[model samples]
Target: MLTRKQHELLTFIQTRLESSGISPSFEEMKEALDLKSKSGVHRLISALEERGFIRRLANRARALEVIREPDTASPRTAPRGPAPVKPVAPAPATLREPANDVIEIPLHGRIAAGAPIEAMEGATMLPVPAALLGPGEHYALEVSGDSMIDAGILDGDMALIRRTDVARDGEIVVALVRGEEATLKYLRREKGMVRLDPANAAYDPQFYTPGEVQVQGKLAGLLRRYH
Candidate 1:
């Protein structure tokens, strides 16, 4: 079993790897662990490596490969032969794979996967910040009509909208109309009426009945490609 300090260091290292898509450097590990000396953290890592809990690439930065971590259960306390180590747990199928290895189409908006393309409210995918998206913050959007010409956003552009149920008026959002078809438009509610205004003049504003449109998330950011 790892000591408290070792556990904390391991957690930090693992979380850092998951967030940064890379292992923590020695100095980073030392600083995170708040150790008085780099050697102290080094000793813990070396011990873990020797025990086959992790493997490091030679002369590589943040190239740690986790082998296996001990199970949470305590030892049986009987002098049994060498205890077999536990295995790494599998990731849930529902979760998206690393964006670096796979194309994570930002859940900007939901289109009719089977029918006409409509704004998809309640994003099904998200962009993780620790990598490109913020610290524990994520965004999702439904690609709607484009109004941001100067911003380089075009129609069908995947909007990496930051997930926020609450946002300032005028922020582009993935909104649901009576929980039916979703759309992308500036969210504004006034005098018991909701307006889904498009950024492009080519598209006219959409007025909604009272409590007809619901906001899923605000446009925190956007992504697009040139023709």
Candidate 2:
């Protein structure tokens, strides 16, 4: 038997995975459950996992799989309201088995590897090996400068970025500053300020308030073409 919130979350996840091949983010789950914060969603997810209802995919951001659905007929499921709707059957195995193939992801224009620059949006698409990506939405950015050369991210290399709004400290991320300019740098938090660190010693780190810096994605892999 599962709690009402648990059942609702599982159903929502299953529905999303069936329609779109990716799992919902923690923010989406929090909003769907009408919860106060993402912590609440974390607790619910942990509970579900402990009961063998779901499994988190390893090495993948925001990835989840519904291992088994709760028994809907149990008296403890709803207790008062109408019986819970049975979850739709899991998607076919063939639909979820292309993790090792090639796929095209949106290729957003160049991102700054030196100074902050506008990350232009366009209709370009980048063909990427699926093995380079994990279980989340992804996009590509063309590197434009040498600030990240020390990180082995050279000029003109294709940066494979996984689309996500949250990242941990010291991780290389694409950060949007003041909702306008975007740059690729290491993310750090210090004294209530967000720090964007460069991999090269020639440049200084940039700092902004927490609200000014928005995480767009993290570096998943790099694609370089030899001349």
What TM-score does each of the candidates earn?
0.46, 0.59
Angstrom error of the Cα, residue 134, model 2: value is 0.4
Q: Clashing residue pairs, candidate 2?
A: none
Model 2 alpha-carbon drift over 4 Å, by segment:
1-100
Q: Which ten residues in a row have the lowest lDDT in candidate 1?
A: 94-103
lDDT of 1 by residue, 1-227 (tens): 56666666656766665665567665677778888754466567666776667766444434566667654433343255333467664221232222231113336344321122455444454433222332123455434444544345566565665556676677766676787676666677877788777656666677888577777766655555567
lDDT of model 1 at residue 6?
61
Tell how far residue 203 is off in model 1, in angstroms. Answer: 1.9
Q: Per-residue error at 41 for model 2, in Å?
A: 27
Best-matching candidate per lDDT: 2
Count clashing residue pairs per candidate.
11, 0
lDDT of 2 at 218: 95
CA deviation > 4 Å runs, candidate 1 = 1-131, 135-144, 147-151
lDDT of 1 at 181: 70
Candidate 2 per-residue lDDT, tens place, 1-227, comes to: 67778888988898888788677776688889999865467667777778777777654546678877754554364667544444445444433422333456778899999999989578487776544665456789999999999999999999999789999999999999999999999999999999999999999999999999999999999999997
